[model samples]
Target: MQLTNKAGTPVQWQDYLKSGHRIFIGSNAAVPNALIDNLIENSAQLHDIETVHILTFSDNVWAKPEHKDLFKVNTLFIGGKNVREAVAEGRADYTPCFISEIPTLFKQNILPLDAALVMVSPPDEYGYCSLGVSVDVVASAVKSAKVVIAQVNPHMPCTNGHSFIHVNQIHAWLTAEQRLPEIPDQQIDPVSERIGQYAAMLVENGATIQIGIGKIPSAVLKYLMNHKDLGVHSEMISDGIIDLMKSGVINNRRKTFHKGKTVTTFCIGTQRLYDFVDKNQHVEFYPSEHVNSPVNIAKNDNMVSINSAIEVDLTGQVVSDSIGHQFYSGIGGQVDFVRGAWLSKGGKPVIVLPSTTKDGCISRIVPHITEGGGVVTSRGHVGYVVTEFGIANLIGKSIRERALELIRIAHPKFRDDLLQQVRKHYWVPTYQDNTPTSVPELGAVELKKFTLGGERFILRPLSPADERRLQEFFYSHTKETLMMRYNHHLTQMTRENSCQLVSVDQHKDLALCFTQRDHLGEIIQAVGRYYFIEASNSAEVAFVIRETQRSKGMATTLLLQMIKIAKKRKLSSLIACVRRDNAAMLKVFENAGFVRGYSEDFDEISLCLTLEETITNAKEIE
Candidate 1:
């Protein structure tokens, strides 16, 4: 068959073919396999022919040893399973570039393409063809390549937005029918489910979110099913988003930028997902230059970017693209969205991974990154790291604090060794506690959110990693409050002293704090704790509230929670010593059924609540 250009002149495929030509291929599921197979069939006519592309789901026959002499393969993103061995074996080349900047490489002739092989939807009535599900960098390749060969497929979804290419631009075309490649869904494991639960908690209602592919991302989407008005501005979307969109959870109505539209560069999922976006007006596809641009992403308020990592060092450096010197995957849009989310208003850049590898023999959290491993997300760019163990907020943390926070969320079996390593490195003081505490069940230690004075706050158990936060809380307290709470004019609370307060065994002695989050990080607004008195068959309780946060009934709330905990422990009684002048605290205790008693210290009065009697009275009242 003879193909013709817009000028109506018959075009021959051999006329554009040359021995040393560099060719660009469409990325992901949009690869034009028919054109590629034809090129391979004519390999005898070509030598030193370089082929460039990003990730592709099709069989990478060009990278095979038999075709190595004829075609030199170079990939922008190293994610194809069949091509990874070739790149690792040094037979194929991997170029590291951000998805957002890939277009510039083509536009400026940096990677200079002689021809582009692409698959597109059949031309519409206006003679314009849509780039379908993979418009990311293919749009630039089509415009910059000298010779454009297209495999027009009827199965390609004719998506909306900046995905159209006029048929006149094509030098030649051939009709083909093929199913787009699909990414099979993997089952969500327990570890991934836990990480997802924690990551989902960081997302708020009516917020924009960017998530990538994999078990952890799917788990996050699973837990977000109940969220309202969620928006998506991601580089790609998978089948995980279909249920959320159908349930009206991801309406994109509250998005600050590109409101009412789900923005993406490409997609790779099942036929169901393709059918969902085929003629869907709510879904819009744009070039990676615009979709992954940090400035464009930051335009949306409350942007939450959740990405996975291969390994993370204690100091917050993330290794994603490679494990040591071996290239695993290409530098995709992780940094782009992370920086974008960091710049957005009320944004959260979250990294979620399992605490250990699949075998559970190696910890993903390490004292340092594996030698030669590239740091894709620098320590400064990292905000939150989540594992099945827990979430660690590392923004604005010191090296010592970062170490402690990361160690706390690491696998328990490796915590002591990690602590020793950090101690040797002087990341933590020598006197820092080395005993690893048992991880609490999620149901028992889940964070409780409450609002006071029109501001939100969280109440949860104090962790050993909270030593610095506890110190900050001490410094935030007024001198009068210190005297009233501790009965001493304490001038300073050293790290050593703060460590003792935060590292107690919760089963024996309980410590809890109320924290309010701001631009700086979580700030402690109130602290309530009780020391178990075994001999007395009771517990000694105390409370302190930040001066600015006082008189808002925080003390009452703390006291009530403490009472509930005490009741659960089945203690005989609860005790406290309050200064006579502290009428507010005295009322809080009294309202909770604490009876005042004479005290030897003239300035202080003793208070006690007998649990047995209180429960009986409450039951009678009920």
Candidate 2:
């Protein structure tokens, strides 16, 4: 086939077509619609033509029943209604692979390409045509294909980074002026919105994010509008990120890799989004291998990977690509980004999905994955899973603890059923019926913000699974500190003791741990707890801070928060049995407005605060 000039006609790509050839198409919206249509219209002349792509939009004609035989559609990743039906009916083949390894498959001839059909923006002054929107594996395919045919669309945006192919590299070109297809915004329902809000709370300022494409991601991005210097390193992004970039919220200033560039493999969004990436120096598009590589993604500090799941089991196993034996979507980049983000400094790998699907008809959180569902992310790789109800941190948690934490975040309507299933399937003798199994009606534990010595701390409720972390926290403290907190000369801290301390009844006890991030991971700086005294309608609280973190006002802040919760729970009073020598604890109690009470022992002093009375007095003064 002869190459065409820059100002080529629309049908010039037809010259490259032949029978018994394998063609690789661009992914998502970047699929060359005109070339695809031409291939289908001329299917009468072609036989056994293999078509390869990932997640094409509605414009694909070969996916129809009539053209299925003409083109053997082999999809790397599956989506859209047509491909779903085709795959279910055995008309099309679905290949399951991690998005990060796709480039290597093409480069190594594992998926040899006879031709590459791609959509590109009009050539710039240097005759370089950009692979707008979807760079992904197309770059590798084009590089290795026998022939490269491009639909030179004027409507396609000229993107930056490793997304460009010189006009001279094309074997044939067709000038097409149609607008790129838009992925319309999903209707953000109250449930999705709430889920987004909860997920957004985990995202910190100056964090590099990898958000998947869809309504949940878009909804989550909406809540991050006010976040500062957020960098994006996603596999696919939509319209929501454009606003954040425009408003200077996502400046990519703090990203260690691609420091000032929003990196992605592909994009799917509206026309406005196309215009935003056009000649935009801030965005860099890379092939899926480089973009989704766990090692590459981990180079950026504070990376947050927010992905979705079809369903998740009680043991933190995520089923994303399939439902039972039915294939839904490809493995894609969920594992790649999940592990990458988890490996990154201050990274959080979050799986955000609605608690229920199909208008709350079914719980996305299930007892098991229906026997045949593929575990896209294994329990070990899973860290955080978020739903509209709340966030469940599953890392370093036992099976029983993970079940309880996950059930706490399930939809309220399904919580009881999930709890019943958990008891039936995963119950142990150590499980106490009197333990408050539910996460309380007040909602998920809010991440309380507190600053000490110019450093910030996140004070959140300690879950039963926090045993390992609490053990580390305990070991980090000196014997003097431990003795003061435990009121004994305890020399050793075991996992069993830590597990007991971290475990709490939501209704009758509160265990709040103050944590901050360091180079290693999240470190517990302090722990405060209050156990209910049924006889006195009060709670006895205790505090322990790492020696280095003491006198930093964390103890005082924790006491105040305990009092607030105590009042909300309708507890009349708060008490603390402080060692006589513990001047720091005594000062914190006094500063928190606690009154010294009568003590039976000489070595300890009793402190009590009338929480209900304090709340009443404050309201009256107000």
Candidate 3:
């Protein structure tokens, strides 16, 4: 409950927690093991213990699946590290927030903390040492932790930045020489290297770089060796950053936060990098909220955010998490950093990916997304998208141009098919399918499921535009129905015109009877009213909203009541020239026990039903 330091060399604490407030320790490679060991010794005395971190690789006691009775995790960004698994397994928890906001949340008492376990270098003669180059977000916590416990070590670097606080600020100090963990650098592909170049090209000098974990990001960093005074403020870093820092390319000179020092949420690089950060005041690690906040990232000058995606549609919708319906990864800091980069002065938000998948059967650049594909980055947020083939700047392109531009950058093998997909979706009339061969053009309405409602009322075209639907509907009708309801002799009518009979309410008494909810607790069981422009109550279809349209059952709710009025009035037996293929409407009348009869005057078929029969069908569903 107090921020007072222990006031002794190699300070120590006998009681870490004295109240409901839990001390939050940074996890991942930056975990303060000295403090953690002390915590274990006193773990039995603690209640409602909570710790927040992206991931950790220690004894795993803090968030072990078996110890849910004690520790809890409030993770920021997910990593392959232990803490992430503990959360997904339910031993811990996932609290989503941008990395940049963690420090504020800590300071504003949004996530109140009673203490903090930090690691740092031993103080110099002047009682000062660096928080190291990784000053990304830990500085905020250092300023706010009620009890600042530092793990002072000589191996830790003394890099310049706002990371260092005087020994007087720390309540307890746990001296140790434990080093930060290292994440190795793997090889990069030629195409990934090219894409990295393009992504890096957009980055101006003195820009803050936020890159994720991958060969692409590493490759992009490779191109920036010649760029001067680039700053680093990101979630994690590998060997790629070590060379830059040693080369004077990353001096952290232009950064707004932790100026003159490297800033990072955590580090996972090589043994060399690990040895370099051991008590080396140059490296610092903090929670993701401080590192990934949009506001925090925007503080740097000329911020450049480079992120990767699975696929990007012509409209610039970036899908980075899924293959289709499967969940590949969670929505992480791409959006956070992208927004931050966009808001920074002279910032550039870029999405970099290969033009096609590994197999090359499918193009990474599509005209539109697959069914149920999630849009991780919206069209408006996208600035630059680059693939091996070319760079697409969809920032201001029209929908049509976007599609063509994406297709142009698509692998040659799949470009034609994607263009055809464009024609099918947007319904751009007179669309050319880019390919020489004629591919049957499909409509934009993706995968239509046969809703039970389709049986009751047809989407009969109201005009020539409806002819296509009529042709499709009638083609599925029975021969007997074709001859009875529609034939060459009848008007060359389509489904659109067939539903144009009349209003169901021809009688005054029965007009309002069926509008009420049926026995099934549904209101649209039947409707009766004057239907067509002619008010032809003489013929009516006693329609019901089918089961398929249950929640969205807007159709039958109106038709059911309409049928009641038509039956109440002795209106010409309620004529109907339904297509023989119209099964839904047929079910309505058939279930109601209404029989079909041919019209001699119009040479068309119709149905006649009594008031009793209309009530019977409406009641059956109820």
CA-lDDT, candidates in order: 0.86, 0.81, 0.59
Model 1: pairs clashing at backbone N, Cα or C within 3 Å: none
For candidate 1, lDDT tens digit of each residue in 1-622? 3345566576665667688888998988899988778677755667888899988888888888888888888999997766898999999999999999999998999999999999999999999999999999999899899999898889999999899998888988877888999886789988888888888878888989999888899989998998899999999998999999989999999999999999998999889989999979999999999999999999999999999999999999999989888889978999999999999999999998899989999999999999889998999999999998777899889998899889878998998899888787888876687533642421422566677777777777787789988998999988889999989899999989998888877777778788976533888889998999999879998999999998877877777777777777788899999999999999989988899998999999999999866632221100
The segments of candidate 2 whose C-alpha lies over 4 angstroms from its true place after superposition are 1-15, 201-204, 342-348, 358-363, 389-445, 471-500, 518-521, 534-536, 579-581, 597-604, 615-622
Across 557-618, the per-residue lDDT of candidate 2 in tens digits comes to 77777777788788988989999998878998887788898999999999889875563221
TM-score of each: 0.91, 0.86, 0.58
> Please, what's the RMSD in Å of model 2?
4.2
Residue ranges of candidate 3 with Cα displaced over 4 Å: 1-14, 18-21, 55-61, 204-213, 225-238, 241-268, 271-303, 310-314, 319-333, 343-346, 355-376, 410-417, 420-424, 427-430, 435-622
Best candidate, lDDT: 1
TM-score, model 1 to reference: 0.91
Q: Which stretches of candidate 1 lie over 4 Å from their true place?
A: 1-13, 434-445, 452-454, 534-538, 551-553, 559-574, 590-622
Scored by lDDT, model 3 comes in at 0.59
- Model 3 over residues 1-622: C-alpha lDDT tens digits? 1223455543224455653456766545556776777665655655556776544545555666655655666655445545656655666565555455667788898877777776677788888755653444466767777777776755665654345678778777766777665567768887787787667656667888888767888888898898898998877676788788899998888888778766676566667766665554555555557678788888987887888998998788998766685434445678888888778877778898988887766778877777767787889888778876545555555676567556655665776677678787673234233321110111111111122434422121021111232344434444444453434334344433422321112222222112121111112222223332236435544232323243434334334444543444445444445556556655555555567887664544467665444552232220
Best by TM-score: 1
Per-candidate clashes come to: 0, 0, 63
